[model samples]
Target: MFLAATTAGDRVRANPGGQAFCPSCMADLIPKCGEIKVWHWAHRTDDCDPWSEPESQWHIDWKTRFGLQNCEVVMGPHRADVVARDGLVIELQHSHISPEEIAERQRFYRRMIWVVDAGEFREHVDLRLASIRTDPYRQQPTTYRSFRWRWPRPTHARFTSPLFWDFGDGTMLNVRKIHPETPCGGWGYLWTKPQFVRRFAVHVDELGDALEDGATA
Candidate 1:
């Protein structure tokens, strides 16, 4: 968890020797400022959200891009990775997840999407050019690609929400449609990093403004 609540109800990042509480469970959190991993708050026991995973730089980067205010939001008994201003929950998943867990989260957070780190599974998946068409509304060319999942994990076929697979490149494969029969495959668009971020993050406009300010003074 990147953000914790101080006694004064202010959200703060974990620092060395900092004392805070989990915003979701209100459990005492210990600040972990180690060198190997991204600094974050941890619960003494594994009593908090059962679905919570170890923090990773990939998770941190995506959360930071969405801004801390909108990240680590409490929804029911679980803390969503990133909840956009428009009430969309963007779950950043890097570690392996079970199909049951995926279905559970989908049921819990009805209005949610997934941004998965494809580094782990992209190797088992092959993509090839399918077709390209221009959108009449946006007047932008849309490229479509077909994917073949060789020996795919069961979880790959269990996505109820939108799954954006990040291949560590600047582009993401947004699975627009899926064919769940044996030897699962799908067709989706390759969205650039900015396109994905801009569509989901409304506060990105504020970030853009801050970057556009000519004066660093």
Candidate 2:
């Protein structure tokens, strides 16, 4: 967790030896201001949220983008990475997670959004995108649903917010507009299908605007 609550119920970033408490568990938190990594708060004992993942520089960078508005927010019994004032819970995921876990989180945070780092899957995504570009379905309006990728499952159709895929580059791909399709002969299998559009590709800095637009829509 990056932000902890002071005794006065104010949110604060931990400094070495500073007194802080977890907003969810109310356990003592220690400030880790080491020279090696970004300054953050950690539980003195065990963390209440077992699902919490280790943070990376990429995760830190994304959280910093929210400034003070993005804090470790307590949702239900767990703490979310960032909960904006607009009631959007932003989860910055950099590692591979099980589909069950993803589903669980989505169910738990009803209005949550995901920002997945595709740095490791760049080559795969590139190939998929290239293939999508030349796909015959790309030219037809009705067949647009056939353009898809593998990672962002089309089965997660219930997710209201767009899943943002960040390749650690300047651009991001919005996977929310994609629709899932099952082949007629296949036995109830969801396939990756996306609607290819130049506008769906956006700059990293424009994420805030995108979220606002998505919220309104």
Candidate 3:
């Protein structure tokens, strides 16, 4: 999903100026290696392969350790040189890339970029971070709990990633709350007492009839 400018097939091959390609992922990595210069162009894997000293040109040290795991600062799909996903891009406040290239990346992708507050990264690099409002697509498993309206109010709404909705307003609420109980106050009472089912049936029947009447006109 790379923008046309960052397309893989158009890469510069073995430029002495310091750019190399990862054979497996085709990400353009700058030639950076410290003690073991021979492994300068090794592909980045989850396992420690080669220790490439953080290049000054990278603008930021993207490698990070969280909890018991280390953040794998490797390349993403065939487009960007560096990548990290929290379902979001992790980037420094200052990295050098063209503005056009950045916009194109946003068109069909998500990327971690180096960002700088004020100074330019490369000469004549008219790169500025553009502010685009994007609703984050949550991609993790969701947990749910049953609520009882008889006493305590809802502490939090339980929703899976896809279940939530963005209500065009500044506030985004779930379009629908998927519970067997049609949102109503009688839910708790009826579930508590079997006799209430009789009354509930009549109520639902009347409500259905009202809806049917409304549909006619």
Question: Which structure among the candidates has the greatest TM-score?
Answer: 1
**What lDDT is reached at residue 202 by model 1?**
58
- What would the per-residue lDDT of candidate 2 be over residues 1-217, giving only the tens digit for each residue? 7778988878887687789888888888888888887787887676789778765677766665555445566877887777654567878787776767788888898887777786776554322322223223223222112234445444445444457667565445544354445421111111121111122222334455324423121
Residues forming the 10-long window of minimal summed lDDT in candidate 2:
184-193
Lowest lDDT block of 10, candidate 3? 184-193
Q: Flag regions of model 2 displaced more than 4 Å.
A: 127-161, 176-217
The C-alpha local distance difference test score for the whole of candidate 3 amounts to 0.27
User: Residue-wise lDDT of candidate 3 within 69-135, one digit each (tens)?
Assistant: 1122334432232342343332332333354544544543343322222222122222122233232
TM-score of 3: 0.26
How many clashes does each candidate structure show, in the order listed?
Answer: 0, 1, 8
Q: Which parts of model 1 have CA positions greater than 4 angstroms off?
A: 134-140, 180-182, 209-217
lDDT for each candidate structure = 0.80, 0.58, 0.27
Identify the superior model by lDDT, candidate 1 or candidate 3: 1
Question: Which is superior by TM-score, 2 or 3?
Answer: 2
Q: For residues 1-217, write the lDDT of model 1, one tens digit per residue.
A: 8889989988899999999999888889999999998998998888488888888988887787777788888888899998885898998898889988999999999999999999777887789876786633225776778888877666766897988899876667887767777778888877766666766785876666323323221
